[model samples]
Each structure stands twice: as C-alpha cells, then as structure tokens.
Target chain A: MPVASLREVQKRFWDSLAGAAGIVAPELADAVVSGTTLGSRARLGIYADAYASRLIDVLREDFPRVAALLGDHRFEHLAREYLARHPSEHPSVRHLGHGMAPFLERRSDVPRFVAELASLEWARVEVFDAPDATPLAMDHLRAIDARDWPHLHFVPVSALRLVRASWPVHELWAGADPARLAPATTVIRVWRDASGAAYHAPLDARAAEVLRLLIAGAPFVIACEAFTDRTPLEAAQAITALLARWIEDGIIARIG
Target chain B: MSLLPHLGHGIGLRPPHYPRVADGTARVDWFEVIAENFMIPGGRPLRVLEQARTLAPVVLHGVSMNLGGSDPLNERHLGELERLIGRFEPAWVSEHLCWGAYGRYYAHDLLPLPYTDEALAHVADRIRHVQERLGRRILIENVSSYLTFTHSTMPEWTFLAGVAEAADCGILLDVNNVYVSAMNHGFSPHAYLAGLPPDRIGQIHLAGHSDAGTHLVDTHDHPVPSPVWDLYADAVRRFGPIATLVEWDDRIPAFEELVAEAERARAIEAEVLGARRQLA
Candidate 1:
C-alpha cells in the first residue's frame, strides 16, 4: 500500500480498536482483534481485559457501596460482562460505566437490589450536576391567601429527584446498618440544598404516589387526591407537610 | 511587569478539589483551571469555578487547542473556551506545545510533535493564527512525552523557543514536565531551561510525578518531589518570578495540603528571587 493509504489503514485500525473497547460498534472488535500483530486471539484479549478493567475501576469508584454489597468477585464479574455488552458512550471517564445499574437491572440473573443501588448513585450524580434555579421563598407563600393553596402549582428545585424502587435504594446508598436491610422496599426523594449538600427523604407508598403526581406536573389539589385513599381530606395536611419539607430542603423553586 | 501579577504557585483545579474550593479553604495567589471543564452548560464545575473565581485569581489552561497538529484547529472549542475565559476573566490563557487532535480525531492526551523546521514553521504559523483569532497572545507550555521521532532535526527546546519568538507568544514553562521528559529522553533539564529566552517565559509550573522506575510519568499524584522543586527553583532564578503554579491532578490532598505545596513553591521562589537580586 502507498504510505498515505497505509497511514489511513493504520488510523482506521486504531479507530476500530478504540470503538471496540468503547460503547460503540461491535463489528470493530473483530477488525481490532485481527488488525494487530498478536497472531493469536490471546493478544486481543488484553484489549478486552483492559477495557473491562478500566470500566470496572470507574464503576468501583462511582459505586463503591454497590461493589461492597455485591462483594468483590461478583461485582468484577458483572462489571466485565456489562462492559462487553454496553461499552462506554462518553469520552470523559466521569461518564464511563455510569449506566451499570440499569444494565444490571436488565439482566435476569441480577438482583433487584443492585438496580436500586445504581439508581441511588445516578440520583446523587444528577443532584450534583442539575441546573441551578432560585429556591421558592416562604415570602411568596405568605403573599398568597391560604385559599389558593389547593390550586397552587409547586416547582421543585433542579436537584430534586424522586425515585421509587421495590428495594430500599436509599438505605443501601446511605450504607445503613446491616440489620436495617430487612426492608423489602423504599420510596425515596433525593435533593441537594442551595448549599450543595445532598439529602434523601424516605417516604411511604402514599407519599411516593403524591410525589410522583407532583413530579408529573400535577396541581397540589390533584396530587392530594392520590393520598386521600389512606387518609380523609388529608390533601391539605399532606400538601402542608410536603411543602414544609421542600422549604426546609431549599427545594421548591416557585409556587403560584 | 507581569501580565498576571496576582497569580502565584497553586495547583491546577480539578473536580475533587471543588468541595475544598467551594468551601473557600484552598488558599493560593491563584488557581489554574482546565478550560474545557468550564465550557459546558451550567453545572457544578462552572458553579465551583465561578465561586472560586471570587476567592482567587484564576488562569485558563487548555489542552485541546491542537496548535502543533496537521489538522485545522477546532474553532468551536476555542469559541467555548473564549466564552469561559470571559465569564471567569482569567488572568492568562495557555495551551500545550503539542497536539491533542489529528485528522479530525481528538486524542485525549497531548501527543508530541516532531521538532523540525517544517513542523516549527507550521506550528508558529498556527500560533500566530490562533493569537489573531483570540485577539490576544496565549502562552504555550512544553509537554511530557514518552517517545521521540527520528525525523526531527532540532531539539524541542530550540523549536519551542523558535515558536515563541516567531509567533510573539509567551511561554508557560512547566518545569516538572521538562524534568520528566529529560529523564525519559536522556537530556539535561538544565540545558532545556538554558535554551529558553528568559523574556518569553510568562509562567512556571511545579508538579509531582510518578517514578515508574524506568520512566517518570507526569502523574501529578503527590507533593512536588525534591528534584522537581529544585528545577522549579532553577526556573525561577532564570525566569525571574513569573507566575508559578503547583499542579496536582491525582491523589489530591486536603485544601490545606495543596496550600502547603503552593507555600513550598513560595519559599523556593523567595530563595531564588533573593539569589537573582543579589547576583544583579
């Protein structure tokens, strides 16, 4: 081949190698494996091994408690297999292997708790990078007549995240005492305050439904109806409760 | 007399240091920020940088300029970088003497360029073009490399000095990278320092490196080692109190610890400046 063509081929080969090891075209893997001077599949194994190892390292850094919960051997095995399937999508190492939790949840053999743990980690990252907005001030609420509370539309802070899981994701993320792990499920609301500290409020099913309704842009009056099944006319009381928590957390952006 | 007179020895700020900087404890005369980190839409990185900007003088050090590459410079990244520089109002903007992209593919690491007349004229022309585009002269820093090309007819130091002189740009002389590359390439760090024109040096860098027994990697994982500090002192003596920075990119310590490292550079600078003044 001409020098230019040869350089092009080399570039293509290396590009294929990078793509194969990332969350990209799998067809590139065969080319990467064959393009090298290894002469055997074992040499190409190094790429696969390094790819899986680097991603597993990223996962272990991002989700240390998840790895601890799954134990070393199981976490490494699962991470290796996960990278082989999903690869990485972003160029930044901060973004690599971020979807490991969802990938695990999709696997039939994986435990549901693993998915919950992943959601918890993802929520933490989301809260950290979420856009900044002005917190809803109590002065606005005081300005409104109490009669308008039912029709009020509450906008939560950018960092506010509502996560409902069959497993106790919050408990796992908090690294709570092992004895408390007996809980089968938990609904959690995670948010970062204006000061950039993260906190999670564990809620019951009724509160979770109310939060979901609110998250879906429902009016306070309509969201309160979901919780009315557990308590009578408690919509007013529940709205008051949630709004107070939101205010304390510096989470509410606006209410009108 | 300095373009960035308020800037002093400080680590290049990364994310792990965000909390410390946000808390307002990482003390130094200034902080160096990777230009790309703040290029994104509003997020914690920009938030922390904006907050830190209030606390200290910040200088923009970029990696993706690709000034020495065959490929055309990415004006999009430069435009975003310019927007960030405006927001932060950084004291100085600096990039590497090497390239990070080739033929449209961006390499995350700074790759060395062959030091020859052709490469020198190519890079110098690009530097002039870049200076014209940004409407300001940017500083160019020497890069750490693991390999050298046989096609090069001139030493990298001479090539770098040529580029600085030809393009009328300043030099952000990274002393630790010089030490690292000298040890790897079997050259004298002192010669590399001696090769540079003192007037062109606008800034200095002191950073830690990993000694892998065979080669010194610019890992920036620990305190500035004794030898690198000695080179930094030598650089200060030669360059005469340019903006000195301590860059720690990995295994970052507490805010106080990074400040302590910067303080070490301060003490060294004081000693070197004292010696230079006495000699004068």
Candidate 2:
C-alpha cells in the first residue's frame, strides 16, 4: 500500500471497528481490533463478545435502578440489543447508551414498562449533566412589578425538564413493585439547582399548567390567567407557592 | 508545555467531588479536569471549572484528541481546547495514546491502534503537528485495550514511549491501565512498569479496576484495588513521585470518599519521598 493509502486504510479500519462494536458482526470484527482465541474464526468472536459485554456493563452502571427492576437476565437481553443500535456518539461514557429509550420503544419484545423505565433513566442522566445557570433570585423576581408582568420573560433552569409519559416512570424508577406496573398517564419534572443537585417532582394538573406557561415564557399575571376563575392574588399565590418550591430546589433561573 | 515539578499526588476532580474541590474542603494537592466537559458553548461547566481552578492547580486531560487517527486533527476540537487552556490556564494538556474518531465517526471509546512502523511514523508526525498547533508540548497517556491488533509490531509500552520520544512530548503514565493491559494480555505488569523511561514521564494516573475472571477491567469506578495500589507504589518509586491522581468516574461515593482516595495517594507519595530522603 502507498504511504498515503495507509490513512485511508486506517479510516476504513475504524469504520469496520465501530460497525462490529455496534452489531457484534464477525466479519467486521476480523478487520478491526481483535484478539486471537481458540479457533481462527472463533478468535474474532472474542472481540464481538467483549464489545457487547463492555457496553452492557456501561449501560448497567448508568441505569442501575432500572437494571435492578428488570433483573439481570432481561436487562442483559435488552442492553445487548440496545448496544447493537447505539454504538456511542460522544467520547465520554457519560453520553453513551442515551439512545436506549428509542431502541427499546422500537422493539416489540420490550415490555412497555421497559421502554418507559429506560426513558426515565435516560432523562435523569440528561438532567444531571445539564448546564448550570444563575437561578432566579428572589430579589430578581421582586424587581418585576404587576404593570410590566404581562411582558415579563422567564428562563427555565438548565436542569429543569418536563417529561410526560403514559406510565408512572418516577414510581417505577424508585424500586416500586414492577408487578404493579400499569399505564397511568403522568407528567414529571426533573431539575438540578444552583448547588448542583438533581431533584424529581411529580406535577399536579395545576402545577403542570403553571409550568407550561412558565416554560412558554409567560409572565406571572398572564401565566396565572390559564388557572381560570381564580382572582389574580389566588393565581399569584399558586404561582408563588410553585415558584418557592422551584427556587428552593434551584430550578428557576430568572424572570425574563 | 511542561508542568512545574509535579507536586506529588492529585485527584481526577469529578463532579461528585466538585463541591469539596470548589470549596477548598478536599485536602488534595492538585486536580485533573476532563477538558471536554468544560468545552461547552457557554455555561456552568466553565463556572465550576473556574471555581475548581481557584482551589488548586488544574491539569487538562482530554478524551478526544484522537492522537492515533489518520485524518487531519479536528481543528474545531483543538480550537475549543485552546479556548479552555486560555480560560483555565491549565498546567499542561494531556490525551490518550489511542485514537477516538475516524473521519466523522467517533467510537466514544479509546480505540486501539496498530503498533506497526507505518502507524508509529504516522502518529508521531500528527503529535508533532498537534504540539505545534497548540503552541506547547502535551502528554500522551496509554489506554487499556481489550484486544490487540495482529499487525502490531512492538509491545504497547514500547510504542507508547516511542510516540513520546518521537513527538518530543511527555508521558502521562496511567499505572492502572498498564496493570489492566498486562493482566488482559498475559504480560508481566512489573516488567511493563520497569520498562518505561522515568525522565520522559510528566504525570501518573492511579485508578480502580473491576476484576473479571480471565482479566481485570479498567473501570475507574471503584476504589483502587490493593495490587494496583502496590503497582502504583512501585510506579512512584520508579517515576519519583510525579503528579499522581486518583480517578473514580462512576459509582462516585461522596466528596469525602474521593478525598480519602486522594489521601491514600498522599500516603504513598510520602512513603516514596521519605525513602528517597533516607537514601539521600
């Protein structure tokens, strides 16, 4: 091979390596990095086997609670398949296996509970590494008066994420009875605070409405309008109560 | 380009221990930060990194240098890296001896490279180019590989030391990875340790490993195993107490737990320093 052609060969070698890692394909494994084992063909299987196992180990570590619920046998089955679909896009293992949820959702063999559980775990990771921000200080909100409230802008905390699912993922995530897993439409909020800690909160209808408005950049008065029939003060009190909780959790960044 | 004489042991300042490092509570001499985590467009990663920088001297360790790749180096990643160096002004920059992305496809894991003569010349030139681009020589650390290439001409340690010498860079000797690779490949761990050129070394990495039946895995999620710690002590004796660090990436206990790990490294460094003093 020409000296210049070596670079092309190197590139092809890496592509084959990634393909093998994703699918545990024997042919691809033979072309990339591998160790010799028992038989000529059997040797490449070592890389395939090792590749899947390493990724499975990473996924299990990242989603231990989910793994605990699914148990080893089922979790390994799902994790191996997930590894075949998502071969990692980011250099950090922190970003690996993020596509497990979509992969789980697409699989007919995956129980509905499994997909929801994976979604919740994946969301937890997303929220954990979400960027940090200067949360809305109490004084910053106080600066906005009722007159300018309609024009007020709001910023959601970097950690604040609203996830709605057909199943109670939060309940299932916390070691709840897997036997009791049932479809219950729900919305949950996950966020980290100024102090860099993560929290999960189940949203009631009223709070969820308020959160929607807040996320849409609505002001205190306009956002309260969606609550209906309540006086402005009532709405203010509800919004204040919710804001207090968010502020305490370090979720609210600033009133825009 | 190089660091001030390494102040002995340090810790991979992970998020779990961020608070302790940020508040000056962790009794660590120094900390190594992952360069990419802080390579965001803008936000808290930088803020926290700045806070950590204030606590102690920081070293920039990266996962995406793709040192062994055949493509032109990722100038975008290098630009981000340059900005981070400007902001944090890290003592030195370091990356693995393996490649990460090939073309646009990134494995995310440190993929092994063939240690043939062609690859050595190819990677050495790239390293020299990177050094010129960054305006400073950096350290290249060895990565643990599950498999070896059939085309490999030299042992991994020889290739690693050769890369450093050829590129005029330094070596971030990851002792745990050396031990892990030794176990996986059925090589002598002590021989691997003894073979490294101590003068070419800039830093030391001491991390935990998961014990598999046939081979040990470099998980960096658990506490340093006893045998690895023993090897680390031997490393300290050979390298003369370079800037050692404890890396606990997953199953991060508490801030105090990491400090306890750092404290363990401190004990080893002290022992090495004390023995040297006695000999002197």
Best by DockQ: 2
lDDT of each: 0.74, 0.75
| Per-residue accuracy of model 1 over B68-118 as CA lDDT, tens digit each | 767676777778777877788888899999865545554455666667687
The TM-score of the first chain in every model comes to 0.77, 0.81
Runs of candidate 1 exceeding 4 Å displacement = A1-58, A71-93, A106-109, A176-186, A228-232, B1-6, B14-26, B39-48, B64-79, B99-108, B113-135, B150-154, B162-168, B254-257
Fnat, one value per model: 0.11, 0.28
| Tens digit per residue, CA lDDT, model 1, A14-101 | 3433454443233323332232223223333433344455567777877787888888999998876775565543324455556777
Grade the docking of candidate 2: acceptable
Clashing pairs in 1: A23-A88
User: What is the DockQ score, from 0 to 1, of model 1?
Assistant: 0.14
Candidate 2 per-residue C-alpha lDDT over B1-280 given as tens digits, one digit per residue, 9 for 90 to 100: 2234775567887766766656667666787989988776444456678887777788999997788877678888898889989889998999998877765556556767777788788788988988998899899999986666655778888888788788989898888998888877778878887777788888888889887665566788899888888888888787776787888888888877777887898898788779978999
Report the interface RMSD that candidate 2 achieves against the true structure, in angstroms.
4.5
Query: What TM-score does each of the candidates earn?
Result: 0.80, 0.80
Q: Which residue runs does candidate 2 get wrong by more than 4 Å?
A: A1-50, A61-65, A111-113, A178-182, A219-221, A229-241, B1-4, B15-19, B37-51, B145-147, B155-157, B179-199, B207-241, B246-280
Docking class of 1: incorrect
Clashes of each: 1, 2
Clashing pairs in 2: A136-A253, A153-A256
